[model samples]
Target: MNFDAFLHSLTSSFTPVIDSSFNPEDYIHVDLSPSNALLNQVNLSSAEDIELFLENFLRQNQKKVAYGGYLEKRSIYDRSEHFSSGSSVQRRNIHLGMDVWCAANTSVLLPLDGKIHSVRNNKNFGDYGPTIIVEHQENEQTFYTLYGHLSLESLDRLNVGVKVVKGEKLGELGDATVNGNYAPHLHFQLIKDMHNHAGDYPGVCTKAELKFYSSNCPDPNTLLKIY
Candidate 1:
């Protein structure tokens, strides 16, 4: 079976990646793409500005979690030079992971049983701060799950090859000061191939490279089933 089909077969119901106390109803789909006119009113460069926007968005929608953005073309990345390629067409703004926006320190859980593959502190600006990659094998097929923007303390106890079960507490979300200077959120992604990457992988890509990146990194929602 194909990767997408394999992911779908792993779960028949909604999978919680954060605070299990929250019901699936508590999550509201958020649009962070450039097409969202509402974003134009806020300063995308400021983490505080983005945080306030998310706070208001969740409050207004009566939801506790705001999630979406797999393969979404976002303009927020423009604020950081890390995503700039000096050419508009080559700018890396297409998000490759599903972002779960909520309060800082929120518990991030594993959606599937896996073992710790690698961990690192990717301290680059506009990058995933404390990241973890978990390796999984089923039906003789091996794959990986990546958790990014985690609290620094989360890595204090993690070790390679540590066994973690589905629904296990992987880590807590980090604040802006540590999590790539963005609003607090979990950047969750699935990878068919690690490409020798450890605790880090390109979570965004330029339009010209979308074809390959999109195929290597599938939509995370296929496993989360939050939509």
Candidate 2:
């Protein structure tokens, strides 16, 4: 489906990714930008530091969940080769997905009806560990969604052609060490075109490729509606 039509469908058809306790008031929408003073105050240069930061931040906010980081320029990515290893011209910082920050092992629900398209363990520093991709058909158009940084146990019993009902418990968020060595969270992305990619897609891209990827992967908030 084209971007505009796909967005309309999500509003009507998809369920919340975290359905159990989804009151918007119970969660804080965070901005992980360079100017966020909290990052500097904590010296967030390591995965452990991030985990601690999120913990304290959530406690202070009187919320159990903290979510954001879509299209955000994050410094946390500097810890791994996935973003900074590339040449200066190709350096990637813009996150292409909406992160659902919660405790590890929190269930990740399927937002809509779908079938498994591919699955793999993207086990690199700052990568999607035990990623799962699902293909959905609506209005005679096919699209895909990627769920990243999932627990290793979540991979069990998944098959390429198996159908998953909307609102079903599909997987759990992975721990920091397993989830690309970062704080526990779910990286949820909606894609119009997989671009022949499977089990993996660029969750971040350089400014040079922003125009194309932004269209290919529209703001996940169209489905998430978290703000």
Candidate 3:
């Protein structure tokens, strides 16, 4: 089976990346893509503005968690030079992972049994603040999962090669001040190949790079089964 198929076979039901107490029904699919007309009213550059919009969104929907955005083209990146430093054609705004938006400090849980591969504090303006990557294997095949935008304290005692089980708490979500200045959320991605990367990988790609990146990073919902 191919990588996407392999991931689907690993889980039989909805998988929670945050607190398990939240059932699948608690998650509402959110649209951050440029196509979402509502985003046009908010100030995309300010973390506080985005947070307030997100709060209203969740409150109106009566949901505790907001998720989605695999392979989604977002304009929010336009606010940061980290993604908008290049020409228009070279701008990297297509997201390659699934974002779980919720309250800050929410527990982030492991979706699969794996070992800590690497961890780092990417302090760029629009980057993953505290990140963790875990390596997993099944039937001789190896893959990886990335958890980004975590609390600084999450990396305190973590060490490379430490074993972790599914559903185990890996860390808590970081706030705007530390998590790339965005609303609190977990950027969860399934990587088929690390490409020698550790604790860091492109979570977004430009249209020109989509062909290769879309292949390397599959839709995370394939494993989470949250949709």
Candidate 4:
């Protein structure tokens, strides 16, 4: 699918990150942009302070910043399922979503103006730490996208059926402990049918379920327009 067209179909503010002008076609194979903070500024001395700042920022601005995905050769092949298992025992089932690496509290945005179809906090290490599922309909097609690993405060005030805008800041990435015990990042994903559930959705899939998962959760770069 044309990622750019799909993105524009969902959002009007997306400007494809391009050199001269925003060209979605030219970005088909472009690398992810550099991390001005995570791999550069975040350090031990600043970890706590940065995390605190992130929390407050989310409280103030209420938006989420994206971080990791398709960075040249650094990305793990989407089909590779043999990732080293984390402490959670769920074998790191090949990252299915682009990780928005950032300090805890970085606000996450709802890419498309949508309604809260579901929301849940799967409280387990290496799990989707405090997640929200937003449902969007475009061209008669109903789809769902998930934002996982969020701050506790993000969910503190939300409930089902809440209205949100395309650029509305929905939540923030949480600290390691509350945000799935990893360097803080938002796990973003797209889903076709939620099957039947609320407050929880699978953020990862095994090889046996790859085909279904892929079809359900389309590439989010389509909406994000980030190369």
lDDT of 3 by residue, 1-227 (tens): 98889999999999899999999999999999989999999999999998999999999999999998999999899878999746999999999999999999999999899999999999999999999999999878999999999999999868999999999999999999999999999999989899999889999999999999999999999999997
Query: Per-prediction TM-score, please?
Result: 0.98, 0.93, 0.98, 0.66
- The global Cα lDDT (0 to 1) of model 1 is 0.94
lDDT at 202 for candidate 2? 94
- Mark the regions of model 3 whose C-alpha exceeds 4 Å error after superposition: none
**Candidate 1: worst-modelled 10 consecutive residues by lDDT:** 76-85
Worst 10 residues of 4 by lDDT: 70-79
lDDT score, candidate 3, position 205: 92
Give lDDT tens digits, candidate 1, residues 1-227: 89899989998899999999998999999999989999999999999999999999999999999999998999899888889889998999999999999998999998989999999999989999999999999888899999999999999879999999999999999999999999999999999999999889999999999999999999988999997
**lDDT tens digits, residues 87-131, model 4?**
334443534566655556666776667898877777764567788
The per-residue C-alpha lDDT of model 1 at residue 54 equals 97
| Cα-lDDT of candidate 3 | 0.94
Q: What's the residue-level lDDT of 95 in candidate 2?
A: 90
